[model samples]
Target: MELQQMRYVVAVAETNSFTRAAELCLVVQSALSQQIARLERELGARLFERTSRRVRLTPAGAAFLATARQCLQAADRAVAEVAAAVGEVRGRLAVGLISTVAAVDIPGALREFHQVHPSVRISLRGTASEELVEQVREGTIDVAFLGLPTTARPEGVHARELAHDRHVAVVAPDHPLAGERAVGLRRLAAETFVDLPAGTAGRMQTDQAFAAAGLDRDVAFEVTNADLLARMVREGLGAAMLPSAYVPQLTGVVTIEVTDAPARVEYVIWSRSGPTPAAAAFLALLGIPAS
Candidate 1:
């Protein structure tokens, strides 16, 4: 069967109305129905059960629908790959990032990439590190910048450390420990803290460090955005632990070294297989050496 026939089948299955599917496919209803009929004849299976009330998929059609969609997607991907190989970068690149990212200079890199591959389209999404990792695994995003523990490597993902900055304690400029160059983790254990929610890479690193030190912090607030976390610290809401880059330098918040906290590492993560040409170009823009 032709790819157009598969598209017609998928369109009918998704819309559930031959008339509507025809409209969506930019074809007349009779032509769409004829194509579907021809596909069923070729396969020697009744793909749809017709009734006056609604168009429904038969058992055979139900089973074939998923496979048809996959075939369409694969065909589209193959075409895109060939086009990118012979022409300028001109495909969609879905990119993911954590809200607290301050490393890798994504904006700068995108600016440079745009100059070279103006036809390429970049779609960016910001979320938690865990969600970003999941998106990468599921192929929702082609590549992402994620916060990961120094030694924790996730399965089925290719990751490269893009940048690393020591985790630091941020406090109000007038706080008692603000004058010190560095302070131990235990010193802040008794103080109320503002931090990222649990399971996030930032929070995970802090928790691991505290666990290693046999100390527990009094977390008074949880925030996902680093700017909001910084605001909380500047407002004297609580002390915070964050990567040095995430803390705004010109703001009233003061960043000091946490003597025992490990460095927060930003990794460029992608699926182990099936990277699009746009993704490869984007990675190169991010300065990841070609493998």
Candidate 2:
């Protein structure tokens, strides 16, 4: 009639003693007896033949005992399989990254994550800060190394800041500004810019920094990828304003300090809950110190 009733029936059948089965189950004999009586009444069958001296199963009781034991065993196996799925530290890690983060950090983290979890398959996606946030929210990716100030503040996500990306100005290796150790926002106003898209917070900061000095930029070109921006600058395109990490060592591009540029921080994020085992491991991987 119920799982507890089935368990009681099986236990009594196994031990051949109501008193011993009750002891085995840590329940009083009278409680076990009453429950068995209720189960028998519910099934409309007498499950045991009781005497003052002994208790023995009816023919129906023997048949039911075997089925009940199998049912309990199956329940155990199901529970164990579910526990292993939720708790195992191996599986696929679907990771998304802002394009610039991939340029700087993903390679090292990818190598380390593989070393620690060889069986885990890593799926990587490259996109912008806003796009990466949406991917995490929609369950298209398990985790992301996305740039911050995600416009939507997507529901059901958790984030951890790995590093703050300080802004740096990049120019051709032989450009006159390249000789300067550090350049000010006012000086940048005269130079045409290769900037991030107009709608980005990065662009806003770039604008505000110069505005503070009673100056404004004439953005000559606009593009999203920092690596691409570096290549453009190397080919004598307009100077790019972005983080040093993204343009570390382009062949013909030189990065210089921007006196009062804003920092664009990066984060490694995961689902607030329901992170697959591998996703959890990957988030842990992000926190690992660089080797």
Q: Which regions in candidate 2 have their CA more than 4 angstroms from the true location?
A: 1-91, 102-104, 149-156, 201-204, 211-214, 288-291
| C-alpha RMSD between model 2 and the true structure | 19.1
In model 1, which regions exceed 4 Å deviation?
1-73, 248-250
TM-score of 1: 0.75
After superposing all C-alphas onto the true structure, candidate 1 shows an RMSD in angstroms of 5.4
Query: Candidate 1 clashing pairs?
Result: none
Best by lDDT: 1
Best-matching candidate per TM-score: 1
The models' CA-based lDDT, in order, is 0.83, 0.73
- Provide TM-scores for the models: 0.75, 0.62
lDDT of 2 by residue, 1-291 (tens): 788888889788888899999998889999999999999998888999999888899998887776786677446435544655766455466788766673336778778889887767778887776677767765667788766432223345776666666778889988889999999877877887887788665576566666667787888888877677777788777887776676654567788898877566677666654566666666555553211
- Which lDDT tens digits does candidate 1 get at residues 1-291? 899999899889888899999999999999999999999999999999988889889999999987886687567567768888788677777889887678777777878888898887778998888888888876768888888778675557888877777888889988998899999988989889998888777688888988889998888899978878888888898998887777654388788888887677888888777577888888877778536
